[model samples]
Target: MPTALPHLPTSRLLLRALQMDQAEVLYRLANGPKIADNTANIPSPYTLQTAQDFITGIAEKYRAGEVLNLGMHVQATGELIGMVSLRLNARHHAGHLGGWVAAHARNQGYAAEAASAVMDFGFATLGLQRVGSQCFGRNKASARVMQKIGLHYEGCLREAFFKNGVYEDLLTFASVRSDWERAL
Candidate 1:
């Protein structure tokens, strides 16, 4: 199974797959407490080697039809602002959404714009029945991003995420295919 990922161009950003040359940028921007603390997969003290490894693994994962990881870039400057992903669950026909924006790029709605594109891809291209996302409860901005993209708050998983040192609540939101179609 090929990645089937698309090059999504929005008004301000270009969403595409991770490139090998971006290891340094991914490290410089994503290797911090701000990003690492919130996401489930990104680890703090992120290293060039780790970024390189992830870049190399993208093709294989895409071929396996399990993951579609996209790097969000500024079209005019080509600077990487963030990343977004859709982790597919084949049996369930569902996709789990994840994303982040660089600290400097925050508050400008870049993450939300890219997320909306991914959600559209998950439902229209991947044929996922539902697309779900979550944020650590303390992160109101992330939760708002999910809500802005039309995901309804489902419930919270108490102490579900153990990052830094202690557990934090996880707020889940989801949007179904029918809802997406109806909106469009």
Candidate 2:
């Protein structure tokens, strides 16, 4: 993706631009069995090639302003910890947030902390009227992160997503600009 994006800072983490050199790091963080089993689309057999392809492929999308993908790093050690992203839908003045943190980094509030900044970027910087996120119904940790970041649970679409040979309930959460602004 783009070599530079808005640098988002939190108490313990820094959300920086995604660099191609981080492909191996990302693959190791995202290719865990627990992560793939709980979410959709993360390949179980994650490879270096997959990481390279993604880093190379998304550059154009990032530069075009169609998407914002950030790399999460520990402020103290500069360790790449995870990622956060916001997808733009200009026509509808909306965007969607998606993110994942390494297993070692979970339960530490990193995801929620980074997500809050991204929500601000979506509503404040991108001028999106609304931003939303989706997680598998059984993905309680992810759901908690969404709620922790100020998104309210809107509803669920039963059997809406098929992952790993089974139909999954998709839980969608969102926050409008007015609500987000009021919360701050």
Candidate 3:
């Protein structure tokens, strides 16, 4: 199991562990309909307590080799712009990637940049054989991010996700280590 979450720096962003001090910022930026509507795990009414708890558990999960959740920040301004995560399945040498950008920072390629760094970490550092991601079919922005990060589209699972009182189709995407390396 990995002992620590390393800080990942991209050209425009820094990916690091979420800190307790940033709970308020996390709550302020994430507690909105736009973010919650697109993600499955984030609750509709994101609270400060939710942010604290999530941060509090990150270390333990990382120690267990189960999850890696990093806060995405702009390197120039040091602003908390979003988050990206890789949930591991060690037995299968695979991982599931997840992420979102703050509404204010959309369409700027930050999500793809940060996600690409994490995928590189997963495959190169963590020795993952494959990494996958899924988004609500309606989330074209997220799907684009997945593609931009080199994950090939898998298949859609019809009505596989139930969110906000409705069942929505889930679009899956993935890439094996060889394919990812070849694309680089």
Best by TM-score: 3
| Superposed model 2: Cα runs more than 4 Å off | 1-4
Query: Please, what are the lDDT tens digits per residue for candidate 1 over residues 1-184?
Result: 3456589999999999888889999988897548988898887788899899988887678678788889999999999988999888989989899989989899999999999998998888878899999899999999999999999999999999888889999999999999899989
Residue 126 lDDT, candidate 2, scale 0-100: 77
Question: Candidate 2's residue-wise lDDT over 1-184, tens digit each?
Answer: 2245688888998887777889999889888657677766668787888878877766677678788878889999999988788888879988889888888888999989999988887888778899999999999999999999889999999999988789999999999988998998
Best by lDDT: 3
* Model 3: per-residue Cα lDDT over 85-133, one tens digit each: 9999999999999988898898999999999999999999999999999
Q: What order do you get sorting by lDDT, best first?
A: 3, 1, 2
Clashing pairs in 3: none
Model 2, TM vs. native:
0.93
RMSD of each: 1.2, 2.1, 0.9
Model 2: colliding residue pairs: none
Relative to the unseen true structure, what is the C-alpha lDDT of residue 135 in candidate 2, on a scale of 0 to 100?
95
lDDT per model vs. reference: 0.89, 0.85, 0.93
Residue clash pairs of candidate 1: none
Model 1: what TM-score?
Answer: 0.96
Q: Which run of 10 residues does model 3 get worst, by summed lDDT?
A: 31-40
Provide the TM-score for each candidate, comma-separated. 0.96, 0.93, 0.97
lDDT of 1 at 103: 90
